[model samples]
Target: MEEVDVVIVGAGIVGLSVAEKLSHSFDNILLVEKEDSFGRHISSRNSEVIHSGIYYPKNTLKAKLCVKGNELLYNFLEKNNLPYKKCGKLIIAIQKNELPILDELYQNGISNGVKNLEIISSKKAKEIEPLFKSCGALFVPSTGIMDTHKVMKKLEFLSEQNGVLISYNTEISAIQKQDDEYILSFKSDDFQVKTKILINCAGLWSDKISEMVGINSEKNDYKLLFCKGEYYKTTKYKDIKHLVYPVPDPKGIFLGIHTRINLNGELSFGPNAYYVDKIDYQMDDSYHQEFYESVKNFLEIDFDDISQDDCGIRAKLQKEGEKFRDFVISNEKNKGFPNFINLIGIESPGLTCCLSIAEYVEKIIE
Candidate 1:
């Protein structure tokens, strides 16, 4: 029966970013998380790569927000003393036939205002990463990686300092709209609290959360398809300085098996896309054969000791055989509920775009 100004569900990066921004303006804010800690879902499971916003179509939310967010994130990390690296990335064209596609990608990056993107010859590409063998490549100097968990922790701390209450292990059951306010029912520990504005930032379960609010169900137009991607870690540390990528599939849904190094300088690969029926993270060893075949085309590696590390699911708005969908941040109109916002299908570059998404959401509510 407590009345609060805002109730944000899901403690992932997006929700936490929004909460951090909202707390600066609103005093009575509650951040609820079904899990015991933040970033346990999609936020923590990703490749932790800070995207350069080169792949998305121009003028779309993904393109604009990701480009904007990339700058903001770099600045934030530097200012806050967080761990990060602007290690750059290389989009490699392994075969002769893929050269044209590589050119198209370089032009797309330039058109999208991606700074310092250069088309390097195969010889120059080898200078950057000696082990990589490619016909041609595009070097994205702005692409980087970071510790996603550390960033989330900083956001959480900042929000708490600004008077935002973070309630963990809290699950929202139902939501209803009454006049200008939204009533949210959630259980925390042994108690429950109902509040006015409810922001659903549930990454994977966002669709189910929308249905709970009487929106985007079988009767509605919006739907979410869960896509699972798995990652594998290489045992031997190869000296690949930059993040190496193969020419993206024309469909643009999957970014072929690539190489990424973490903050500790450990190399990891994979995240091949596969559509799934349910949300699960169980690693299947049988997929190793498929992974080896997929990655062997671009880089040579000893897969002898390679093992499954982790997996992440992307909540996509598109169905099977569909191109990548843009981020959907809606409030009220789509579901007829004022002060209730639903963010569905926030996948790749999501971590990079977290700050920009938060700033946009704050403007919407303001």
Candidate 2:
């Protein structure tokens, strides 16, 4: 048995961020990952957008943490010499009727303390983005893109520098709460170990992990709906300057198809949300036609050059037709394990809000 003060499962951004903060306060911290490399899951597969905290409801954890994390992330990137760009974003209203919704989003953003969100006229929008055609748009200057893998590496490095032990290829088998601490069982290629305090940041398998610890009562009320979003790269427009997004559905389960330019200056649009049974990354070429039709209303580009790139799954906590749900951070209250914490359905803005989630989890442990 290799006892530790804290054991963090999953080496995704959130887990690594939590380890980074806790490493400074506690020694004997262990970070376990099932993958051969860190961030093989949601952390690496996202659109890499540093969100501006515009959509979430006011004062909720998502809104507050996203706003705060936006500031913290940019500062951290600058301090660490990471590759990132504040390319900005535009939420366009293609239909005249959708303009009201766009306006409401702008007001909501203002109320949420999202700085520099402006509602620009269609002419102004076209002036800003010559290829964009819309009735109206909301400009969010804080939205941007970054090398998420690099960010994760930096986080892991910092945590390791502070004495947090990272063990890749290690999978947690079970967790049990003892008198004063958690007893966690983990198996790796070579060995097995047990630890004390358990931090369940196991992205997709979070509910299963909680159940393993006999915390079924605290398991998410809504089943994890695996919504896989597929992206397509545009060979025609390779150097787009801004992220172009459509007015999100009022329900807000999925942000409409949008374009994001990566750190390499390659433009890609996608993630048309589709519910799936398994975590599959297979891109269906048939959807490419649908992508062309869906995005043509807002963007003026040659769809002939569009091709499948990659796909990422969102651990959506919301049921079908329901609005987007907030991140679930469960501690002793629901689970009965004093030191055990589980983070479930941490999807979009999750990459942006990773550090803030870490700080929140730290407060819970303390």
Candidate 3:
């Protein structure tokens, strides 16, 4: 068995971020990925939005990390010459009744220390976005979009440059915790490694990974719920300047089907939330009308202009009707699994929180 000081599973944004930061200090770092390349799952899919730390409960990991990560990510992007847009965002309220929710979101953002969040009147919103029709809007100046692929590639490059050994097409089928190290067995390849630290950054299979090491995720209230969100690309809007979002679902289920502008000046709407049994990228056309209605509620878009784009699954901890759930980043020493770090239910703001999350994990290991 090859022995290492640290083993990081999964090559998603968060995992890559962790490896890149830790590689600066730690030697013999091994990053293992199941896919042939990095970021095949959640990292590659979705809006690639740099969330502005809004909507999450105050003092939660999601809130703190996202707000902090927003700053760190922008700095990292600039330093590395990675492409991104500080294109801003607007959470709009269409009906008069929804204005309260808009206020609540602004307040929540303020409580979470999000800067430059404002409640703009209809005329002010129109001045910013003429096509946007709303009673009121929460203008979030910090929200932006970046090329996730570019970000991941840069992170991978930096990590590799620092002597981080990345093993692709290798999946950890099982894991066992010895006295002070973890023994990881590969699925197809007959190989195992003993590492002093095991960081479970596995995006979708995090709960399963926890269970493999005798950690009952459910008992610890870190159970995984696979919620799939589908997006639809728009043909009508191309040069839209900012991300246009509807008021969040009243049930507090999701951020609602909103308009996301990519870094390449492309527009897509969606990520309407629903549960899925298995991981599949196949887009269902049945929800196109639903997408149309949702977009029409906030933006002036015809149904025919939108087409089925793609989908991404979120590793959620909260089930349907559950108002809120925070990201679970824990060093399981108290659970008898010292040096084993588990990150669970890292969904929406996860991409935004990648760098800050890495710093959080670094402090834990220290």
Best by lDDT: 3
Model 1, residue 286: displacement in angstroms? 1.7
lDDT string, candidate 2, 1-366, tens digits:
667788888999999999999998898999999999899999888799999998998888899999999999999999999999999999999999999888888988898899989899999999989998999899999999899989999999999999999989888886666675666666644344555568889888877787777766344473577888888888777677899999885667778888968988898888888788998777768798888887788777566878899989998787788765788886755445667787888989899999889889988874
Ranking by lDDT: 3, 1, 2
lDDT of 1 by residue, 58-132 (tens): 888899999999999999999999999899999998998998888888887877889999899999999998887
Lowest summed lDDT across 10 adjacent residues in model 3 is found at 246-255
Give the candidate number with the greatest TM-score: 3
- Model 1 TM-score is 0.96
Which regions in candidate 3 have their CA more than 4 angstroms from the true location?
Answer: none
* Superposed Cα deviation of residue 200, candidate 2 (Å): 0.9
Candidate lDDT (C-alpha), each: 0.85, 0.85, 0.91
The whole-model C-alpha lDDT of candidate 3 against the native structure comes to: 0.91
Q: Give the TM-score of candidate 2.
A: 0.96
